[model samples]
Target: MDLGNKLYTLRKQKGISQETAANEIGVSRQTISKWETNSSYPEFDKLVLISKLYDISLDELAGITNINNKEINYIPIKTHYEYISKRKIGNIPLIHINIGRGFYKAKGIIAIGNIAKGLLSIGLLSIGLISLGPIAIGLLSALGGLCIAGVSIGGLSVGIVAIGGFALGIFAIGGFAMGIYSIGGAALASKIAAGGYANAPVAIMQDTENIKTLILNKLPNTPNF
Candidate 1:
């Protein structure tokens, strides 16, 4: 069935006119009419609101292609290192953690093509925009939308980081989250690596001990880990 038919049927089921649906969804009646005529589809956010209005799932409303009740496109599995720990793919060695600790899980390790990684990559891009705010300002200047060619256009100098403005406003949110995750992961990796090195096997441990003993015997408190 056409989306328009669905929309028309849903409206009648709810006993509301197109005008009422439009008002509730913050769109014009003509837009609803257009949708009902199969001339266009609702924009994504509006589709979400419409789903709620009709008390239907987004998959049902949008007619998701081949969607199934058990389809798990975005399951957030915890650090089950078994999934990460061992594998070889086309001559590239796989990285792994010791189930409970290591660098392998720092960046949310998972099967390749994980949405979490994609989201992180997008977040990096949004942050790159902050660090690229000068370009946005230059475009505004070119549009003659600024007071002068480059006057207070925002996101200039200071390395594209405008303290408080539209250029970096929303991106700052994801940027902060990314920073926290990255820094936390890096720090945890450092600690785990340090602990691992301290507890390495006898031969490697002997090498480390020999190196440390030599340093201590020849030099006092002058070396670092």
Candidate 2:
């Protein structure tokens, strides 16, 4: 059976409502409903949490069981070697291990499920030059829940140029910002800052008169509120 069926059966057995499950896992009720209906799958962390909550092994949740069958007597050695060892799709490795290559040409490029580490990687928790995932650690540009990079954007961000709900960088913009040049609701900066409650050498309140010129001069590229 698929994961959805397994989850439904498990929840029904436990006599738990979808809302209870959602609260336990920090997700919306709709997210739980989606997982139960096979509309979507939970993240790796959520799956682990769910498995623990149900007091079952991950293998059981995935519907994997021990079984043996005697069908073929002789298996080719080369076939086993080719399929199980250092397999590649064109230049990119399909199932990469320690060292690999993705769609791009770069050394030490790993693109696996859940975790990936390489020059340009993509996965749930990825680390690379241009990483894209739920939680990314890209040196140049990163985007996720809590990101740190040269240019970062997320709920909580730290970078050279950061933008998020709470941001810290050389140039930042967020609800609660702190940087060299900050612009947000509660901005705190060293040089120039603009926000409702700003603190800096050069401060411009969001409601201050003639603040447009200061904003234009300090943060010319910042998006309009």
Candidate 3:
């Protein structure tokens, strides 16, 4: 009904201790306790921090008004969206999608969430047969900011066949690449390398000032060229 009671109720509903709330709001635990007990009032800036930490509007945090024109003394309901398909393979669902403010994990044949794991996953951090995320790890292929898989394509990629700004693999292509067979602005390899500045046993690179073309060992003598 009052500011102190509202703070207490909101903190309790948010499932955080007084110490945790105090740390998040940049105050001492004793200060949080005093505020909740109405021994001391919070400053305007502290109130803003409290409202943000508790994920409630300033009006709601202060119990400003309600449709009934009564002092509101109820916790705000947080909405979380989730979907799990009925069709499942083994114990995992065919499709699982979970989206919300807080951290949520989705695991299924096709998973999508903040953090996901599945045969085909898409999320912030994903792991699966084929993953798509900011940071992804996949068995077959991956496409993300940082990717690692059999075949990867991202800003920084590592795999059997990698293509990105900085790539490392058996066959790599990027601005800076290193592999057995590499092609990029700056390429380094053990076998065949081709780029503006290439270095390998068999290198095909542009002739730059003072940098001589190096052809060390002969191309590997393999039946399959």
Candidate 4:
């Protein structure tokens, strides 16, 4: 039989009233009546919902078995929109351009992926205000392999106040540090410096009191010792 006849038969078999079926599927009773009488057709999505509701196969509902040797014509759904368009969530733009380093193309307020750039970015290669990645670059504080920021901490760091394996800044601290005030295994500074092998204008070999005195003198306005 046809789709309308099939729907009517299925609803009757399930012992559900037209009004009940319509309410269940978010439609009016008149719409259900039209489907039962073959006066109107349902959308593809609604048809799928109906199929599930009736516990029947789509092929069975379309009367495919009854039309043997009859070539069926198919029509495509038309839409005026790009399938793969850029989308946004709140103030953040979410884009994925699959070109050279595609993940690098993604930018937003808070981004995360292979490569990202945002206010707080986190990825393999990230750049932002507070960035954390294998190769991260931030304006205030950074943590990564090769970091550069106002206060940097990573394997190789360079900033005003840096701390890492190989650090270079005004006040550096690391395995190998070089700055105006340095402290590490191999330390080198212009002024007061201290470490295992310290080198500076005023180097403290193993004097804690003198080191504190120099740091305090250099940063007189510094608080909380």
Please report the candidate that would top lDDT against the real structure: 3
Which candidate's TM-score is highest? 3
What's the distance in Å from true for residue 114, model 2? 0.8
Query: How much is 217 displaced in model 2, in angstroms?
Result: 13
Q: How accurate is candidate 2 locally (lDDT)?
A: 0.69
lDDT of 3 at 160: 98
Evaluate model 3: give its TM-score. 0.63
lDDT by residue for model 2 over 60-175, one digit each (tens)?
A: 66555412332223211110000111345566544433212222222235554356666566666778776656787888988887777889898888999999999999999999
* Prediction 4 TM-score vs. true: 0.51
Candidate 4 segments whose C-alpha is farther than 4 A from its true place: 1-104, 207-225
**True-structure RMSD, every candidate:** 21.7, 17.6, 11.3, 13.6
Error of 3 at 136 (Å): 0.5
Q: Model 2 segments beyond 4 Å from truth?
A: 1-110, 211-225
lDDT (0 to 1) per candidate: 0.37, 0.69, 0.82, 0.72
Given candidate 4, what's the lDDT at residue 67?
30
Clashing pairs in model 1, backbone N/Cα/C closer than 3 A: none
The digit string of per-residue lDDT tens for model 4 on 78-188 reads 221111113556655553221123232346666665676777777788788888888888898889998888889999999899999999999999999999989899899
Where's the lowest-lDDT run of ten residues in candidate 3? 208-217
lDDT of 3: 0.82
